[model samples]
Structures are given as C-alpha cells and as structure tokens.
Target: EFNEVFFDGAVAAEVVGGEGDGWSVAMGLLALERGVSTLVQQIGFAAELERVVGAYVAAGSGDPVLRERLVRQWAELRTMRWNALRTLGTTGDPGAPSVAKLLWGGWHRRLGELAVEVRGAAATAGPGHWAHGTPYELGLDEEQRLFLFTRADTIYGGSDEIQRNIIAERVLGLPKESR
Candidate 1:
C-alpha cells in the first residue's frame, strides 16, 4: 500500500512537472533509510556504505547546482553513521575523544562545503528560490510560512554554522570567535 502510494505520487509529480523541492528531499531520505536497512540486514556495514553513497549520488543528480550541496548532505549522513558505529564499538563506554573528534571534524568540513554551496546557489538563484516560488512576489502569509519551513533543513541534523564552529575549534584548533 505504501509503495503504491509512493509510486503514484511520484508519477503524478512527474506528469505535472512539479518543481522538485522538499517533497523530493523527503523521498530521498525515505529511500536512503530503506536502503540502509536492507544493506545492513543482508551485507553489513561496508555494503551499507556503498548503498548510501550510491543513493547520495542519485539524489545529487536531481539538480546541477544542488549537486555539491547534496554531496555534503550525504557526507553528513555518513559521518552520523560513523559516530553511531563508534559508539556501539565502544560498548557505551567513554574513551579517547578520537572517535568523536573525527566524526565532528568530518561533519564540520562537510558543513563548510555545504555552506559554500548554499551561498553560491543563493547568489545565482536568489533567496526563496531555493525552495519554490519567486522571492519578490510571495504573499505575506506565504512568506511567513516559507520562512519558517525553509529553516527546517538547516536545523535538522544541526545548523551548518554550528557544525562549522566545531570543525574550526576542535578539528583545526583555531581560536573561537564570538557569534
């Protein structure tokens, strides 16, 4: 039933030429979850990585400008997977910060890359263009709604800026700057 609905919806969007946006991202996440689960069950961790990387590439291919952004998104997910594995490997016991450091470091670097992508896209596409609809013509209520919802991506795993700070301080050993 779920697969039926999912496919039907995707077909409808294709027929209508829907402006790929949040809905596409949601579908990608769902596919990633399912792929990861199947790979974990059948082939284990290494296979799971392969599955995720493939999924990431496919997702990124959706938009040329968004490709690098999606790659960074994939990297963030991979880092999360690494952190989860490390925690499990430690048997829930604390040890050297090396594992956490590596995870955070990777996350930070990816966040920086994503930031650049976002800024570049924004410069070319302009604000509110990242989602849907034109920036100048959004109605008041629509504008407010989009403003709130568009933030969902940045906040979801972690804000890109926060991730950047982690990379700079812990990974790069740079002095902290006040926000």
Candidate 2:
C-alpha cells in the first residue's frame, strides 16, 4: 500500500506498475518518509504538508501558537544530507538511510516533546482524564497523542539499534554483532 507511488507511472503513453515485496516496500516507505521530512525542512512546506498547514492557518482553527512553535521546531530539524554526510562520509550513500532513520527517530521524539511543552503540558504525564484506572483509557490530548506516536519512530521503520548496526557494519565495514 505504501510503496505504490514508487511503482506506478505512465511510461511512453502507457500506464505501468508492479507491486513490491512487503519488506522492500516497507523499507522504501521508511526512506520515503525521511526524505519527505528532509525536503520539508529544506523547503519549509509544500504539497500535502503545505496544504495542511495553510488550511489550519486560513481557518484559524488550529492553535496558532502551537503552529508557530512547530514551524520553528521543524526549522531546526537537521538537514538530512548533512547528517548523512557526517555519519556515512557521503550523501545518498547506502548508509545514508540508516543515519537518516536514526536522526528521524530522535527528531520526531523531540518535536513531540517540544510541541507539547510549548502548550504548557507534559507529554509524558500519564493518560489524560478518562476512564480512570481502566486499561483501555490511556488519557491523552491531540498533541500528546502525536508525541506518543512519534516516540515509536525509532521502533517503526527500523529500530535505532538496527540503524546503528547498519551504520557500523554496512557503512563503517565493522563486523556483524554476534548473535
């Protein structure tokens, strides 16, 4: 589902496409997400991201202060190519994705933390007011929910440990860790 964009296109006046295996597709999705994030950092916002932000600002429906804070925080997101160059000795190398993924995990986590903090709330504070003592009731507001979601960035796509290992073995040519 996620990698469809990479597979489909009109070639020579003919639509062409094919599905990729799950693992490869998932990996591509992770890389795509990181690339998009970096692009957004470089170009402010565009396409869907731009549309979302603009809609919020136009309608004045979302919290303006939070929006501004997020804009600033997003601006601080590391340049993907720069970080990749530092870690892998080159940009767009095989190891770049590993480094980018590692950075993304931390970046999203920090964005979540900062966004919630800017709103004078603790994102780490336990479930919001809801069915008290109920396991199903994990209290959280929108921003905190976002924080919780981004906290899993390290584990999703690929774990930080995995990315580190990729960098060590594939990029740095270190030996694989013993099982």
Candidate 3:
C-alpha cells in the first residue's frame, strides 16, 4: 500500500463554500488546520526523537556527526514548537500557515533520515524470506517505513517550493512568479 491512492476523482459532489471560491475556502481552512495540527504533530515528533535517541544510545557508537545531528534535530524540534505556538490564533498574517508547513516538513523528513542512519546498515535490509510464489514481500520495519513515508512530507500538503512562494508573496510582499 506504499503507492495507495486513498481517494480518486470518482466521487463528485457540489462545492460547499460555493463555486470558484474553493481555493479561498481551502486556504482559510488550511490556515486554521495548520495552526492546530502542528501542536499535535510536535508530540509525535518528540516521541520519534526519543526513539531515535534510544537507537543512538543502544548502538553505543559515539560518531560525533550523528551526535551533532541529533542535537540539532532536538533544537529544531523546540524551534518548531515555539513557531507553532507563536503563530497560533493569529489570522492577520497570510503566510503563517505556509511558514509552519515549511518548518516542520523538512524537519520531519530529516528525522526520518536520522532514524534510518541511527540504525546504520542494518536498517536497509528487510525480511530475507519470500512468501508463497512471490519473489518479493513488503516487510518494512518501523525505521524503514518512517524513512520511506517521510519522503513525501514536503510534497503532500504543500510542497516546500509552494510554501516558499506563499511566504514570499504573501508575507514578504514579493512579486508572484510568472505562470
């Protein structure tokens, strides 16, 4: 189900907020959604950070690079939480949601990468045995799953580029990019 499409264009329905206003409605909702969801997401991120730290500790490998990365990740997590709290309940800024999205999207993806890296080479391999007649079986462990799934973190809700554009144009008063 890695490439599973949750929903396609099969179910057509009338727009609730009115025709031609879908973008506006969606943006308004997204602004509010981003504010609230980020706080919840920080909890999950904190747990994941602990898991990564546990892996690092259990390994007993003092690779300075990873140690520094882990510390940086912790700092970034704190920054993300503060950013979310700072922007919460504020509707005056148009790019606040995009800012939040941009902050956590990259951070989560990096955490996924860190999760796999903390496990070293062993994290790359899956179950060695095949099932039935199939030569391949999908048996990704937690770290592997996290690494693979977070690849789309920046692309799903709004891509990093899109978020940057939003911040540039809406927040910074920059000119919009040409279509």
Best by lDDT: 3
The top-ranked prediction according to TM-score is 3
- Candidate 2 residue-wise lDDT, 32-79, digit = tens: 556555555435322323443444565554776768755754454545
Write the residue-wise lDDT of candidate 3 on 1-179 in tens digits: 23434445533465557657768888999999999999999999999899999999999999999999999999999999998999899989899999899889999999999999999999988787664547754677878888998899999888999999989898899999999
Candidate 3 wrongly placed segments (more than 4 Å): 1-19, 130-137
**TM-score: which is higher, 2 or 3?**
3
Judged by lDDT against the true structure, how good is candidate 1? Answer: 0.44
Error of 2 at 60 (Å): 19
Quote the lDDT for 61 in model 3.
Answer: 100
Q: Kindly give the stretch of ten consecutive residues in candidate 3 with the minimal lDDT sum.
A: 1-10
TM-scores for every predicted model:
0.26, 0.52, 0.86
Clash counts for the predictions, in order = 0, 2, 0
For model 2, the run of ten residues with the poorest summed lDDT: 44-53
Q: Which stretches of candidate 2 lie over 4 Å from their true place?
A: 1-72, 81-92, 121-139
